[model samples]
Target: MKLLINIVRWVARFLGIFLFLFFVWFAIEIGSPDLDMMSNQEVKLFIGNLIMLMGLIVVWKFEFIGCVLLIGGYIFFSLVNYSFWIGPIFPIFMIIGILHLFCWLADVFRIAKKISFSTRLFLK
Candidate 1:
């Protein structure tokens, strides 16, 4: 059980990091105007990049916030651009966020359980 929990925690952390890096890369790509000179709508790209940066920051300390940002970005972009590619990306971010959240909760519960058990043993 302990090993399993540790494994889950590591996996969750890895996913969180992956999500952060992905968002950063995405923001850089979109925010850069040189590569996408054909597109005249620079404002939209700037806004998207800002959102991604915010999501990256929030996700570092708070998984839920990060998840919300990522999922929200996916929805917002898809609706604005009417693109089908976002359909697949949206779920991936949502899932990663959920997994990270669950792992965090599990760790909290595990710690609480240990404290309670230790207290009971001490009292007895």
Candidate 2:
């Protein structure tokens, strides 16, 4: 169980970083397209990527905030495009959210165990 938890946490982290870099690559590929000419899709792409990047960046120190932002971005895009949410991407987001919650629980349990162990030692 511990190993699975660690794997999930690491995979989520990797995905977050990968997605951030992929967004940068995508933005660069457009090569200074006219902002006024850009469509809603393009605008959403840029904004969503920026938000996700910010969320991922701070996730290291603030897990809940980061995960919520990450999942929220997914939800927002799903609603706007109405494409990914129905497809495989939905499962990916669901996995990430569940993994995040599990990671939080694992940390809390670990901390509680340590505190209990220390208290027991002190009492002895």
Candidate 3:
């Protein structure tokens, strides 16, 4: 159980880092020579979304914030002429975000309860 928890933590951290880096890379790519390359933007957008989702899955807390940023980023990316996953698939992300939110809330409360119990015990 301990090992599994550690593994989950590591995976979440890895996903967060990768998602952040991808966002950076996406910004740089669009800011560079490929600025006018509309043809390939959809591909980039899909990849970005995929990376973001992985991060979302891995993150065990503050998922709502993460998801909001992800959605906002995707919107901005779209405005700049970035093609999304499969035929206007922006809603797909929304659906995932909603699901993630529920799971995140559960985890957050569970963590909070555990911490509260431990703190109470320690105080006693």
| Clash list (residue pairs), candidate 1 | none
lDDT per residue (tens digit) for residues 1-124 in model 1? 6677667656756765676688668867877456455464455645654564466567657766775776576556555666636555445555655665666677778999999999999999
- Model 2, 3-118: lDDT tens digits are 88788889988876676676568779866667688799878865664565677776777887777776677767666666665465344544565567679889889889999999
Instruction: Please report, as a residue range, the 10-residue window in candidate 1 with the lowest summed lDDT.
Output: 40-49
Over 13-93, each residue of candidate 3 has an lDDT whose tens digit, in order, gives: 554565556656876777634435546666566555655555455435666676665556556555545444535345454
Task: TM-score for candidate 2, please give it.
Answer: 0.67
Q: Candidate 3: misplaced stretches above 4 Å?
A: 1-34, 37-66, 75-88
Candidate models: Cα lDDT each: 0.63, 0.71, 0.56
What are the RMSDs of all candidates, in order?
Answer: 5.1, 3.4, 7.6
Query: Deviation in angstroms for 121 in model 1?
Result: 2.0
